[model samples]
Target: MSHPQGKELSIAVVGGGISALAAAHRLVELAPRCRLKVFEATGRLGGVISTVHRDGYQIEQSADNFITTVPHAVKLCQQLGLEHQLVETNPQYRRTFVVRQGRLHKLPDGFLMMAPTRLWPLAVTPILSPLGKLRAALEYFVPPRRDDADESMAAFVRRRLGGEVFQRLVEPLVSAVYAADMEKLSVLATLPRFREMECRYGSLIRAMRAQRRLHPQTTHESGARYSMFVTLRDGLTSLVDALAARLPPGSVCLNTEVVGLQRA
Candidate 1:
């Protein structure tokens, strides 16, 4: 990365995480003379996505698996030729349980977030009161609110569903993922498509149903290949090793740490 005004053709990448590694790799591919280097603050690279094997247990520090439905991760796997090692989640365990009333309860099938494609099951769900369910059901009649401006996850869920659903269901579900306060998580930033869906269809359920109808083959197609969750067979580290192997000799540095950054 030659500073437009400087002589050295050098590039400085902060953090030896995947983004920095991928950035350097891309730079090497596009401009071999760019002299790209990655700087990591910690003793290790790979950031939070490190794997530990102890006592015959392989544990992921963060990001247990990537969703196959997302193309970027799948494409990377194909590029690395790690397709053979790809592991898919068991289809039978598709249902994810949510913590409710100090207990884990299975979320009803066909319930995509607060949107319920199947009504009877939602109507009978113990997660919410009948009154709350009625309030959620009335969404079909209530016109979309003009105040569609960005709202927090809690606000969005409560408005569409009810206070009970937001408190018991969405709160715990969000906690499972981001582990952040519902009031702080922006619905538009986190799930913008959902904001759009409500804007288009008065009801969230109606929007999901319409989407399912439009892309029926995706959900209804029998024996759909690939699972929602995926990882490497040996472990996530295998994926990291695969990438490291692809780099040219003397390219990647191990045990390197960086402290300060400043422009000269």
Candidate 2:
């Protein structure tokens, strides 16, 4: 687009992944006449977000769905005129299960990630032992960590909810989503809201209970807020294709990896 100095602004995006493609598309929308280029190390786009079709079924390589609570993906789809293709998760199967001793047990209702909004379900879930359940319940009275320092997810869960809850419940659930080591995964970088809740309400259980009271519909929900998740009907590739289509012709340069940069 034209700059304040009456010159066209040129932009270069490094990567052909969904994030980079979305950025280029947004830039094009905001500045229709701007010069842009996208460089991809691989010959293909979409990164790990690929969909394969075979035998009348769609297979997702990585993430099959995106959570709508973030709003960015939904807004992007709407902007690309692909809102009609969005599909919500089945209502009847919104719950998540965790395996313990080679058996599947339903995650407690109203237990969203690390905290439980409803205590009754947490009290009754077989996922935790009597001692574990009692420990989790004590979270209501646990003092908040007053400092702003960062801590690992494992540490955070153990400190607030106890080791049993971390091992049997939180670890599996969080690992399924992030696939990262709990000992190294930064709680501040991932789910800072939990820390904020602890600071504001002084206890995770108390904070979650207050939130449930504020948003009563979530009282019966469970696990990772599956009700907020959705996927594209055709597949996530449609989103990549739509983004690539909206860019100017010859804007994408595949198999072009930048090794170093220097001042011109």
Can you give the TM-score per candidate against the true fold? 0.81, 0.87
- What tens digits encode model 1's per-residue C-alpha lDDT throughout 123-226? 87787788988987776776676775888888888888778777766676665566588899899887777778888887787897787787653342111122
Best by TM-score: 2
Cα-lDDT of candidate 2:
0.90
Weakest ten-residue segment in model 2 by summed lDDT:
255-264
The C-alpha stretches of model 2 lying farther than 4 A from their native spots are 1-10, 262-264
Model 2, 1-264: lDDT tens per residue?
568877787888889999999999999988988888899999999988899999999999888899898899999999999999999988777777998999999999888999888889989888899999999988888889999999999999999999999999899989888878898999999999999999999999888989888888777667787778899999999999999999999999999997765432
- For model 2, how many clashes? 1
The deviation in Å at residue 15 for candidate 2 is: 1.1
For candidate 1, give the lDDT: 0.70
Q: What lDDT score goes with residue 184 in model 1?
A: 91
